[model samples]
Every structure is written in structure tokens, then in C-alpha cells.
Target: MLSARQRQLDRVRTFLFGSRTHYGAVFTVFLYALLIAIGFVYLYPLLFMFVTSIKSPEDLLNPMVQWVPTQIYTENYAKAYRVLNYPQTLTASVVMSVVPSALQVAVASLVGYGLARYRFPGKGLVLALVLATFIIPPQNTVIPQMLTYKQYGLLGSPLSLFLPAAFGQGFKSAIFILVFYQTFLTLPKVLEEAARLDGASDLRIFLTIALPAAVPAFIVLFVFSVVWYWNETFLTVIFLEGGVTTLPMQLSKFAQAYENLYPPGVVNIFDRLNEAIKMAGTFLNILPLLVMYFILQRWFVESIERTGIAGE
Candidate 1:
């Protein structure tokens, strides 16, 4: 009985400290630590922005006030909101970003479906061209695009953005197409064949079967499109030419706008109001995106995981 008990204890010790378990535990700890460090590095800037935005002018001037403010200045947000023309700009951003994103998804899905399911002449060539388009920078074609838009009288209109997306040439459209292509290809053929044998039309089969399976991809693409379009400035500045002013563009020009709106003596160069307003603008600009991400976070995560599974 004593010998058996001793052997059992030895087995338990070996199991706990065995080569496989020990290596796995060490790797897991290292991975978690690395992730935490990376998260802190990335989040520090946003944290500072929030802290500074809430600081009063007096608190900001005091060298002692670094992390926390003695008094929270909520008025910064109010002033920032007025400076940004939040109501109008928010409407413009949603129309510009969300509309184009939805249109691009529709165009990409159709193109990807055709490429994946059909065998046409020059099929390989078409796929190669799509891949080639991914490598070509958008800036290289901006000159020609501007010229073409000018000829069509689309230079100052939102149509310039929408038409390209409607025709399957939106920003980073190739990636979206690839995602759908891979997703459609991964679906089992038996499902489609069964529908066909039941005398269902191709459209009916796609709408009923294929589209449902690809819901995850759609959600993922929509989120990405909104973020990219929201953050876009350089292209919008050129295309719209002051016709549209998004949150980012407004934030970038906050100082000039502020000076124009108020008297010079109202705020000094190093005044906390100046910096705080800008910080508050930045925070408000991203607030909607933050809300959106939090709301759809589960769907977004599931979409990515599902896309990976489909690719595999």
C-alpha cells in the first residue's frame, strides 16, 4: 500500500510538470503577457486624449496635473461639437460612408459569385487582372480618374464615389471580392445541386442558399468599409473639394476654424481651451465608431472566425 501511494504521487507530479503541459503553460503565459503589453502601448494614446479633453484650462497649465484633472471641463465637448457642426457632418459622413459601403458589397458579391461559379473564356486572365489591381496603388490612377470624372461632370458630386463602387471598382474592392470568392468556393456543391434538381432557378438558389451562408462576410465588409470611409481625408478632400467636410477633415482644420469663429484674444496660443477643444473633437469623431464596434462586436468576431473557417 505504501509503494502504491508513492507511485501515485510520482505520477501526479509528472503529469503536472510533464514536457507537453510545461511547454504549453510557458507559451500561454508568454503570449498573454505580450498581448497585454501590446494593448497598453496602443491604448495609451486614446487614454491620454480622453484625460486631456476633460481637463480645465487651469488644470492643463499646472505642471502638476498630468493624469487626472482637478475639475472636469464638460464644456469642451459642447464647444467642439459646435465647431465641428456635428449634426450636419454626422449626416454627411453616414450618407457618404454607409451608402458607398453597401453598394460596394453588392457589387463585390455579384462579381465574386460570377467568378467563382462560372467558367468563362479568359477566366484565369480575369482572376489575374483582379489580383493585379490589388497591387496597383489608387494614387497612380487618381489623375486619370479625376480627368474622367471631370469629363462626366462628376468631379464635385458624390456620384464620383458611388458610381465607382456600383461598378465594382470601389476602394480596396478586390479584397472584398476575394473574400466572397473564397467563401462561395468553400460551400458544398451538394446543396446547390439539390436545389437545381428541384427545378430552382440560379437566382433562387443563390438568394436562398449561398447568401445566407455568407452573412458573416457581409457584416465584416460593412464594418471595414464604414471605418475606412470615415477615416478617409486625402481622397475626399480632392474629390469633394470642400463640398463635403467630414469629422476627420473638420478636426484637422479645427484651429483655423476656431480662430475664424471667435476673436483672437478669446483664447491664447497655449490656452487649454484650444487643446481641449481639439481633443474633444477627436473623441467625438470616433465616438460613433466606438459605439458601432461595441454593438456589433460579437457579429464581427464571429464573421472573422467564419471567414477563416471557410477559407480553410
Candidate 2:
């Protein structure tokens, strides 16, 4: 018994210095620590926003109150809602984000499926062009796009944005196409062949088998598309202009509105119009995204794993 115990201790010491087991454990610990640090870095800003948003004017003014507020200021949310014109902006944001996401998802999926399953002349060139297009920053084309939209009197219309996405030219659309392409490429050829042997038409097989099998890809793309569209400010300003207002746009306008509402001449305004209110508006702007991520985080993880299988 003593010899067996002595051998186990010696093995453990040896493993710690020279074996994969201890090295793996140490590497995992380091990775976990690194992830936790990164998580904190990303989350700290959000945490500050929530905390600052819930603070009352008095609590905000008090430098001593860093983490906890003396009193919760529920009114900040009400003020933010009013400032943002929440109902109207929320509706516009939903339309802007969801509509483009749906259109882009459908179009990109078809394009990706075709690229992955079929081979033809110029296929490689087409894919290369797509990837190259992604590298060309949107800023270069903004002038031409604006001029074209202006020529058609679509400067302030959502259609200006929608039409581009309908044609599979939406924001970061090439990336979504690539994602779907990679996912489709990972599917087993036997399943497709089996379906074909059963007299399944190409379209029917794609809709019934290929698409259904790539649910994770769809979910991942949809979520990412929504996020990109939702956070988009530059394109929204250029295309929709004043015609549509989303939460992020609303937040940008808040500072101007604040200065106008409480000019430098105003008295006792320092306590009311502070960073807390600005942060409150920011919190409201991002709340929907936070809710969405929490709800679909599981699917996101699965998608990450599945997306990597193509390279493997």
C-alpha cells in the first residue's frame, strides 16, 4: 500500500514537470484566467452603464458612491424612453434590423448553397470577387451610393437601404455568404446523394435537407445580421437620414438635445443633466441586444463549433 502511494506521488511530480496531463491542466488554467480577464474588460463598460443609469442625481453627484447608489433612480429610464421616443424608434429599429437580416439570410443562403454544392466555370473567380469586395471599405462607395440614391429621390427613405440588401449587397453580406458557404460545405455528401436517388428535385432537396441541416448556420447568421444592422449608424445616417430613427441614432442626437434643453446658462441643471442620463440612454440603446444575446447564446456556441468543422 505504501509503495503504491509512493509511486502515485512520484508519477504526479513527474507529470507536473514532464507529462502532457499536468501541462494541459496548467494551459487550461491559463486560458480560463485569460478568458475571465477579457470578459471583465468587455463587461466593465456595460456594468458601469447600468450602475450609472440607476443612480439618482444626488447619488451621481456624490463621488463617494462608486458602485452602489444611495437610491435607485427609476426615473432615468422614463426620461430615456421619452428622450429616445422609444415606441417609434423601437419599431423603426425592428424594421431596419429584422427586415434586412431576413432578406440577407435568404439571399446569402441560396448563394452560399450554390457556391458550395455546384462547380462551374468562373466559380473560383466569383468567390474571389466576393471576398475582395469585402475588403473594399464601404466608405469608398458611400459617395456613389449617396449620389445614386439622391438621383432617385431615395436619400431619406428606408428603401435606399432595403434595396441593396434585397440584392445581397447589405452590410457585411459577403461575410454571411462565406459563413453559409463554409457550413454547407461541411454537410455529408451521402445525405444529398440519398435524397437525389429518391427523385428529390434540387430545390426540394435544398429546402428540405440542406437548409434544415444548417439550422445552426442560419441562426448564427440571423443573429449577427440583426446585430450589425441594429448598431449601424453611418449607413443609417447616409441612407435613411431623418426619414428613420433607430436607438443608436437616437443616442447620437441625445447630446445635441441635451445641450439645447439645458443650455450653459441654465441653473441647477448640473445635477440633472449629467453623464448618468447619457449612460442611461446608452443602456436603453443596447438593452435589446443584450436580451437577444442572452436568449440565443446556446445556439451561438453550437454554431461556432459547427462552423469550424469545415476547416477540420
Candidate 3:
């Protein structure tokens, strides 16, 4: 009897997942398949690059159907390291990555907490302005932003990036604010009131009561910081000028060097090792972000989802 009941429950689940009535389960499956196919299509080039990065010089150059390295040459990574100057790149990447993210989280959480907890005039207007910032094209602001930074004696300074974050601005501070605000707003007001009754000032409420209660949120922000700093190119390029270069820009410069050398589809001669080194360089560039995502991706998703739910 138990076996028969278990078999019936399994069949019901299978029917719900695999069968369609007016809902068009077939269409859902079709869309999923299409998305999977497209994803693989986009991934193939990167996959090819990774494979080529480990291939020997002659094997890398051959335009044949070789997918795996005929003879693996891991030394391409060493060559890439030397060419890119990893120590300088590491130093530059670290400063820009660590500071902005920490400050952004701090700013976002504080602003979000205020927006969630405080009732004030123009609060709606403030939220509106925050949303509007997302609509402005980043490219449009780059030139003017650079000029302003220059006038303020901030051009080519990492402080320019760090400072905006310290004050509660950067990429989509509005969205992050919204996210954290929505999350914080869901907390029981009694908690804040009780803390206030104990002689906790507003600052004490924020630092001691609220910020400490937001660990999951902090983990999400930390991960976002790691990824954004690793990938930030345009703003960094504009602000840093030649004063600093992050990993992305360095990799781009490497790509441009190859493009200029071979001119892509117009050239005949090139160093096979350099091409492999480019591949190696790209792998190194993304390695940290990949590791971070793999490690903290669960916490990041959980924090966002749980917060969103609490807000609702």
C-alpha cells in the first residue's frame, strides 16, 4: 500500500512538471531549451579561448578542428603574468575594489535605513530622484564628471571613486538604497521604539540596533563590490586616466595590442604565444570573481530574496 501511494505521488509530480493544459507547458519547455542553446552559443568562444590558452604554439595557431590542446603549455599563464605585471595590477585592482564596495554598502545601508524608518517631507521626491539617477546614461555623465573631478583636483585619484561611495553615490545607489530600504522597512517598528525607549539616540539606533542586524545584506553587498570593482572599466578609465589601471582595462589593453598587431582579419603574422597569453590573461582576470561567486553566491541570493520578501 505504501509503495503504491508513493508511486501515485511521483506520477502527480511528473504530470505537473511535464504536462500542459491551458498553460502551455510545452512553450515553457521550448523557451527554456532556446535560452539554454543561446547561452551555450555565447559561451563557446570563451570556452575556445580557455582551451587555446593551454595549447602549445603550433597547436594554438592551427585553425583546424582541435578542441583540446595537442600539447598543453601552462607556461602561457606565466608569460601573461610577466607581460601584464601582476603585482602592480593586483595592487591597483585591490585598492579600487575594496574601498568602493565597503563604502557603498555602508552608504546604501544607512540611506536605506533612513528612508525606511524616517518620515519626512520630500521623502517621495527623494525616492523619485534616486530612481531617476538610474535612467541617466553613464556615458553621458563621463565627460562632465571627469571635468568636475578635474576641477576639484580629483582627476586620476582613486579617492574620486571612494569618496562618492563614502557619501552615498555610485552606479545605482538608488536601487541599492531601494533594496536595503525595502528590506529594512519590513522590520518590526517595535524594535526601534524599544531601543529608543532605552535612551538610544538616532545614531545609536542606526549603528548599534540596525546595522548590526543586517549581516545577510552585508554579505550581498560585499559580493557585489567584488564583482563590480573587478569589472569596472569606463568610469575607472576616465577617472584614473593613466594614473591607475584595473584588471579589465589591462586585459583590454592586451586585446588592443593584439588587434593592432594583427588588425584582425587583415593580418598574416602574429605571435602564437601572445595569443595564448591573452587567453591566459582573461582567465586570470575573471578567476577571482568566479571564485567569489561560487563561494558566496548562495548567501548573496538568499539575502536578496529574504530581504525582498520581508519588504513585501
User: How big is the RMSD of model 1?
Assistant: 3.1
Best by TM-score: 1
What TM-score would every model get versus the actual structure?
Answer: 0.87, 0.87, 0.81
Give the winner by lDDT: 1 or 3: 1
> What would the per-residue lDDT of candidate 2 be over residues 1-312, giving only the tens digit for each residue?
569889998777765554644464556678899999999999999999999999988887789999999988887777777778889999999999999999999999999999999989999998998888789988899989999989989888889888989988999988988888888887887889899999999999899999989887787788889999999999898888768888888888997766665565764664356778889889988988989899888878787776673432
Q: How are the candidates ranked when ordered by TM-score, highest leading?
A: 1, 2, 3
Encode model 3's per-residue lDDT on 127-227: one tens digit a residue.
89888877887887788878998998899888878888888877566667777887687666787789899988998888877877777777776677667
lDDT, model 1, position 202: 91
- Write out the backbone clash pairs for model 3: none
Q: What's the candidate order when arranged by decreasing lDDT?
A: 2, 1, 3
Cα lDDT, all candidates: 0.82, 0.85, 0.77
Residue 112's lDDT within candidate 1 is 83
The C-alpha local distance difference test score for the whole of candidate 2 amounts to 0.85
lDDT of 1 by residue, 90-200 (tens): 888888899889999988888888888888999899888887888998788888988898898888688878888898888788888888888888878789889999999
Clashing pairs in 2: none
